[model samples]
Target: MSNYSIKAISNASNDAIIQLKELNISFGITEKTSETLPNPAELFLGSFAACILKNVERFSGLMQFGYKKAELLVNAVRLENPPRMDELTYELTIYTQDEKLNSTLLKKNIEKFGTIYNTVKQTCKISGNIIVHKNV
Candidate 1:
């Protein structure tokens, strides 16, 4: 089993910071949350986004495909009563001229193999589509 650990510290009046690896991320906490720093919910969604992107890079070599770049847009809705995210949608745009890239297969691989995507989709509704733009 893989293991991971991080540390976070904050005062009641100041923003919290999480020491992850060699990087320090300062984020909002309680009333300290603002537009400047990402809140917990946004961070959660960011993790999901990162997982998807990471898998894309991993699958590129496995599937024998090359791409110029990939862009993803994620949208989420939070339910106030239970105070949780209820829905998430994503649009992935891949810029590539590779004929080996299969959109359907790639989507299935992401949904099945992604760690964070599976975790969030267990309780939250997730719907998305992949669009491929060919280069001329």
Candidate 2:
């Protein structure tokens, strides 16, 4: 993974391309990206969740913490009049007993450092909490 910090997660959104070095992922995105892909809202929700998960790996290294795994469940509310995602909530579970793991700091970093999270929060109401499981 790339080195990332609360201040170092400095990339702005709206680019057509994304690359994940560790995962060997490099793809260019476009409007109506792929017919095989899920609908826009579903894709957005996946992106939202992905951002959080990515940040967990990110902050874990930057913050010097360890975790076995992390899981996230994201739920959204749809508005039909204009067709939009109005609200988003997430349940994030991090399985770790690292003494250095700080939930409060982690949550704040994830929220502030996330690309999709920041973009979505600009227009939608977002609320979520991080659950740290010490013995898993």
Candidate 3:
């Protein structure tokens, strides 16, 4: 098994920074909120979306498919009583000439192979649909 780790440091305020290699991401700690930085919940949802997109690119190469571009939108529903994500929904749009032929297969591979996707699906209700737009 391979082990991965990230480093995070926080000051006295409600702000923290996470480091992964050369990347640095700032997040808010307290409920006070900040327009510049994401909160913990937002970061969680964003990580899910990022994982799906990364897999989309990986599967495209492995399956020998081509696409002009891809876009993803994600939303999460939080339960008030428990204060946790109850459900998550995502919409992925892929711009490619071969629309109907490969969309389903690509979507299947992403759900099957994505690490974060599978992990999140275990605890929260995850659902999404893919839209293939044939590039002109």
Candidate 4:
């Protein structure tokens, strides 16, 4: 088994900075308020999106498929009473010239193996579609 961890420091307000020791990256975090920085919920959704994209790139390399670029747009619905995410949807656009690559299979593999995707899928409804575009 693999272990992962991060450190977060919060002030008096609803904001904090998270440090990823392994990645050597730090990000400012805040609650869902009027702050300009990203909130926790947005960060969660973004992490999920990033995980899917990472899997896409990994599969493309392993499957010998080439893509010019990939883009993901994610939307999340939050319930007020309990203040939790109800559902999440995303649209993945892949620009590629590889016609032999099956988009359906690629999406399935990502959703099946993605760490963040599977984790979030357990608590919220996850729905999305993959759109492949022929790169000129």
Query: What TM value does model 1 have?
Result: 0.94
Q: Over the full model, what C-alpha lDDT does candidate 3 score relative to the true structure?
A: 0.88
- Model 4: residues >4 Å from true position, as ranges? 22-35
Q: Can you rank all candidates by TM-score, best first?
A: 1, 3, 4, 2
Q: Give candidate 1 misplaced runs (Cα > 4 Å).
A: 30-33
Candidate 2: which pairs clash? Answer: none
- lDDT of the structure predicted as candidate 1: 0.92
Say which candidate scores most in TM-score: 1
| Alpha carbon lDDT of each predicted model | 0.92, 0.80, 0.88, 0.84
10 residues in a row with least lDDT, candidate 3: 97-106
Query: Candidate 4 on 24-120: residue-level lDDT in tens?
Result: 3333453454366676777888899889999998999877798999999999999999889999999999998888779999988998999999999
Give candidate 4's error at residue 50 in angstroms: 1.1
How well does candidate 2 score on lDDT at residue 23?
A: 39
List the candidate numbers ranked by lDDT, top first.
Answer: 1, 3, 4, 2
lDDT of 3 by residue, 1-136 (tens): 6689999999886689999999999898866666767988899998998999999889888888888888999999999987899999999998888543488888899899999999998998999999988763
TM per prediction: 0.94, 0.72, 0.91, 0.88
Candidate 3 residues lying further than 4 Å off, grouped into runs, are 31-33, 99-101
Residue pairs with clashing backbones, model 1: none
As a whole number from 0 to 100, the lDDT of residue 72 in candidate 1 is 91
